[model samples]
Target: MASIAVYSVKGGVGKTTLAVNLAWCAATISRRETLLWDLDPANGSGFLLGVEAKKKRAAQSVFTADEAPEKLIRKTAFDNLSLLPADESIRTLGRQLGSIGKKKRLAKLTETLAKDYDRIIFDCPPVLNELSAQVMRAADLVIVPLPPSPLSARAFETVVEEVKGSGRKHPPILPVLSMLDMRRTLHKQAREANPKWPAIPLASAIEQCAVTQQPVGAIAPRSAGARAFAQLWTAIERKLAAKK
Candidate 1:
């Protein structure tokens, strides 16, 4: 299975939105068995997909080898899609992983899940630490979502360095602009400067993801936000295929 991580050191960039929506597209549209793994303590992926964690701090067990991930993975309402939800217990994961000193432990666990899932989408935490290092080692492609701002550009650069400095061959990164409003001059200029970078326009459908707890694609398939996600998923598929 191919592991795709929707990650960014900067938070509030719609990272979780991209992760959940793309996983939905992969499962519902591409017909791939997808696992949306929530590595963030906030549990955004689980909340968005309407899956609840059965036990507190259960997610960290997988990383610690105390419990098999398969036992903790919960099926979502969507077909061919499942979730390994996270909880507050993950807050100490960086320290725990550092103590273990098995850099590839997460990668090995991902390999074990390959027998079941065709794709694993990680909703990563917004932090610079050992957890990020582990994700860098496991992911095949990294998707970094940025907004139309100078800070976002710097965050993009930091993400690039973080991925490359993982002490291994780095994964390819695709930077996407999120919450873009073409009416704004800043957004327009950002888009013009990097025409190749996919942008998700500001839309109510996407914002409602928190309230509706469903991907924009599942709620409004023809909406601009949904279309953007579909197109992005296509690009991700191409990147993974080329890697193979």
Candidate 2:
């Protein structure tokens, strides 16, 4: 199974939204048994899936023998999709990871889950610490969502450096332009600069994900937002295949 991490060094870049939507694309469009693993404390991924983790402190326990992730993992209403939700307890994950003194602990856990899943998407927190380090080691491909802004370039570079410095052979990074609105000059210019990069437009359908508790594709399959995610997933699949 391939593990994909949707991460950013800056917050409010739509990392969780990307993770959830891509997970839906993988499961519903690609027909892959996908797991959306929320490593962020906010648990936005679960909220988007219309599920919430009951054990408030159990999220951090999955890294050790203290908790079994299989028990915590809950199936979503969408077919072929499941969620390993996060809670506020994950905020201390960096400290817990450092104390354990085991590098690649997250990677080991992902390996165990590989037997049951075709795709594992991590909704990583927007931080540059041990938790992010562990995610870098675990992820096969790191997807960075960059909202159209001048500061986005710096954030993208920061993520590149983090992933590169994570391990000897780090996972490849894919930068995606999120919340893009071509009608705006800045957004149009940003797209022009990164013409090859996949772009998810700023649409009511995408924003309605929170209100509807469903992916854009599931709710409005004909919408541009849904098409963008589907195309991006297809591109990701091709990238994975090429790597193999």
Candidate 3:
């Protein structure tokens, strides 16, 4: 299975939204058996999917060799899609993972789930810690969402440096421009500076997903937000294909 992580060192960059919508596209559009794993302690991904942030066991269970991740998997309303929700216990995940003393434990966990899933997407926390390091080690592709700002650009540089410092073969990073407000001069300038970067426009339709508790593709398939996510997923597929 292809393990894709929607992550950024900086928060509030639409990382959870991208992860939820992309997993929806993978399950509904591409018809892949997809697992959306929420690694953030806040559990925004499960909330977006209308699933509560409750897990079957303690946070440590996820990294423990004796525990089976399947037991924690919760089926979503959509077919071919499942969610591994996060809980309050995960607030201490960085410590939990550090105590395991295994850098590649998360990668090994994904390997065990590969037989059951065609694609695994992680909605990761916005932190550079042991947990983040573990996710980077496991992911085949790391999708970094950046808002239109110089700080975002600098954050991307930091992400690149972190991957380089991992001391292992790292996954390819795809920088996506999220929440792009075309009317703003700064946003326009940012887009022009990185024309090749795929962008998700800041629109009411995209924000409506929070109220509707569904993906844009499911709620407003013809909308620009949905089209952007669809196109993004297509690009992701092409990148994964080329990697193989």
Q: Which order, best to worst by lDDT?
A: 1, 2, 3
- State the displacement of the C-alpha of residue 77, model 2, in Å, after optimal TM-score superposition: 0.2
Model 2 Cα displacement at 106 (Å)?
A: 0.3
lDDT of 1 by residue, 1-244 (tens): 8999999999999999999999999999999999999999999999998899978778889888889999989999999999999999999999899998998888999999999999999999999999999999999999999999999999999999999998668999999999999999999999999999988989999998999999999899999999999999999999999999
How many clashing residue pairs are found in candidate 3? 0
Which parts of model 2 are misplaced by more than 4 Å? none
Taking the tens digit of each residue's C-alpha lDDT, what string does model 3 give over 1-244? Answer: 8999998999999999999999999999999999999988787888888987444445457786555788778888899999988877777778877987888888999999999999999999888889888898999999999999989999999999877777668899999999999999999999999999999999899999899889999999999999999999999999999999
Put down candidate 2 lDDT per residue, 98-213, tens digits, no spaces. 98898889999999999999999999999988989999999989999998898999999999999999978899999999999999999999999999999999999999999999
Question: lDDT of each structure?
Answer: 0.93, 0.93, 0.90
TM-score of every candidate relative to the true structure:
0.98, 0.98, 0.96
**Greater-lDDT candidate between 2 and 3:** 2
Q: Residue 87 lDDT in model 1? A: 95
Candidate 2 clash pair list = none
